[model samples]
Target: MKEELLKTFGAQFETPLIEEISTVGKLAEVPAGETIMDIGNYVRAIPLLLSGAIKVLREDDEGDELLLYYLEQGETCSVTMTCCMGQTKSEIRAITETEVLLVMVPVQKMEEWMAKYKGWRNYIFESYHNRLNELLLTVDNIAFKNMDQRLVEYLKKKSEVTKDNCIRNTHQQIAYDLHTSRVVVSRLLKRLEKLKKLELHRNHIQILEL
Candidate 1:
């Protein structure tokens, strides 16, 4: 665990900070599609991604979900950090996008490290800034972009995060992430196919132009 932690975060974190994380953080491996955190759940820890990716999502009262952003290796969720600091329930859900390896740092350590480590403080602030930008981008896409354009951007993001041009999520799953109907997603996907942007398969999508 220490070696993995160092390999993932050593460049960004001070030696002492890395040592502290290795000593106190719990290593976890989660499979793809597993929900690591959910709305209304009290956050006990913040995750530091070591490998793979996790997608953070927001949910409405109607139970509809929209993907906020993806956290890849060496990234942490700022929203989760906020919840930990406030001792509040999570407003978003975090799910594994692929098999993931991460280190879970207890909530208390978050504050402790902020005061003790400059690297930790910088990391926390940077996480917040990056996440805010992503949230704004999501809003812009929904408000200004067409459904097809949003879908194409979403696929491009997914492909980038998973490091694969072939997307394995179903149309319905993509609909849930985009906060739209499966029928709508399917229709848009077919349109994209005809436009030579992507090729739709029975269970996966192969990116072409996107």
Candidate 2:
């Protein structure tokens, strides 16, 4: 399972590295509403989110949390990568329960792998490229799309093909996903709910009609 999860990083590298990683790292189960890692906390590894959901958030000067979409199953967390790369301090947190397969690559191991395996380097680069593309698309959406359109489009895109249903992403989270204020999201969600298009439950917002 770990091997296949890492395979999503790229097709070039051998999945056997997951076994090697297992020797050096460990698996963690984070319960609902738990903080897997906090902003400004330094961690020296990359985590493959094996199950459940995690959110990336940025806090405002007033100490309010802004939702930054989520890192869903099969998707690795960006804060983990940034920390591993020794970049700026992370400003994100896990917003939901999650299970992660952690891989810690020391400096020596990084150098050795880069020297010994071209495929390994290709795999890492590819993962970064894909992340950049996701970021770019996000930026483009925020710049060009209206709030209603963006929110509806995000729901449509994330909905399951079978029933066109998606996980109950919260209003605040949707506001963050749209890069808008939660008050706006609240108003919009109220409007959507009134239209009989969605239903709200404790900590969850379900789309009732596509």
Candidate 3:
């Protein structure tokens, strides 16, 4: 499985760092829709995706949730980094959006590698910057954008992220992600369809102009 690590990021880190990862990292294959991390729970490892994607979400105490972002191939979850750096539980949750293959570095090794290796330090910093921007964008959408515009942009992003113009999701699923009612989502989708922006079937949405 060490080869899998190299395959994901070949020669990007020094040989010593690579060897450390090889020795300490564990490979995991997660099925689509499975929760990898949970709210208020401690995260023990920082995962580096080798393939597929993970959806990151933030949930409140009352069980209300918001779609935060998605981590795809070659990306690490910054929330994991935060858990590693301090004594803290996960504030957000991560669920596999598709069958996922990832290498998990134990929290100890994650902290050690950050201090011991330059490449690992850079990687952690980059992950932090990227995820921070994603969270900010989510906030901007919620605070400023209208639900219809947000829904359209969300669909466009979903299509781009999955690399499929035909999105395989139900109206209820979309509503849940957008923090809106299913009836509202259905109405917006119908409006988009009528405007020639997209076509919707039972569970598939085909982008025509978006």
Candidate 4:
């Protein structure tokens, strides 16, 4: 299982060091749409994605589902720092069936590892920096981009069903991804369709560059 994680990364640094990370438990074939961690629940182990994709989503003020991001194989855990810092409530959910390798990593253990292993500590530091940069980018997008621009970019990335070589995604799903109302998405989509900018087939939207 540890070998699988190395696939996501470019190269294996040191086999002996990774092998020394005592395996906690193998969570195999986790069913789709299952909550790996719950809001207000305490998370102990550091989860590493061994296989499958996971969707990180949050609920908005009006009880709407908003997609934060998708986590794929090779990416480390998300929002674990909040859990580590004793934050009781988490705003994300796992939206896909995922196989994860859980390491029994406590805060003290992390400190000890940092103190002893410079290489491991550097890896951890880089990981945190990457995560912080990602969060900052999301915040910048939200603060600077207009709603339509954000929605358009989001749909372009998320449209999974490509029919006839055209990107297709549902309006409701796009609304969830945009953290806005479905009706707003529908209205905008229809307007775009009428303007010959895009085409709509039932719930599926075909993106047109024009």
Count of clashing residue pairs in every prediction: 0, 0, 0, 0
lDDT of 2: 0.62
| Candidate 1: segments with Cα more than 4 A from true spot | none
**TM-score, each model?**
0.97, 0.72, 0.94, 0.71
lDDT of 3 by residue, 69-180 (tens): 9998889998878886796999988988888999888888876777898888888888899999998999999999999999998998887777789988899888878888
Q: For residue 146, what is the lDDT in candidate 1?
A: 88
Which tens-of-lDDT digit does each residue in 1-210 have in candidate 4?
Answer: 565545543253245445545343344556655777655567665555555666666676776776666655545554765566564566566555343333334544555556666656666676677767766766777899877777766665454311132644466667777777789988887777888878888645676764
102 Cα displacement, candidate 2 (Å): 5.4
C-alpha lDDT score of every prediction, in listed order: 0.93, 0.62, 0.86, 0.60
User: Lowest-lDDT window of 10 residues in candidate 2?
Assistant: 99-108
Least lDDT summed over 10 consecutive residues: which range in candidate 3? 4-13
- For residue 103, model 2's alpha carbon misses the true position, in angstroms, by 5.4
State each model's C-alpha RMSD to the native.
Answer: 0.9, 4.0, 1.4, 4.2
- Superposed by TM-score, candidate 3 places the C-alpha of residue 146 at a distance from the truth, in angstroms, of 0.8
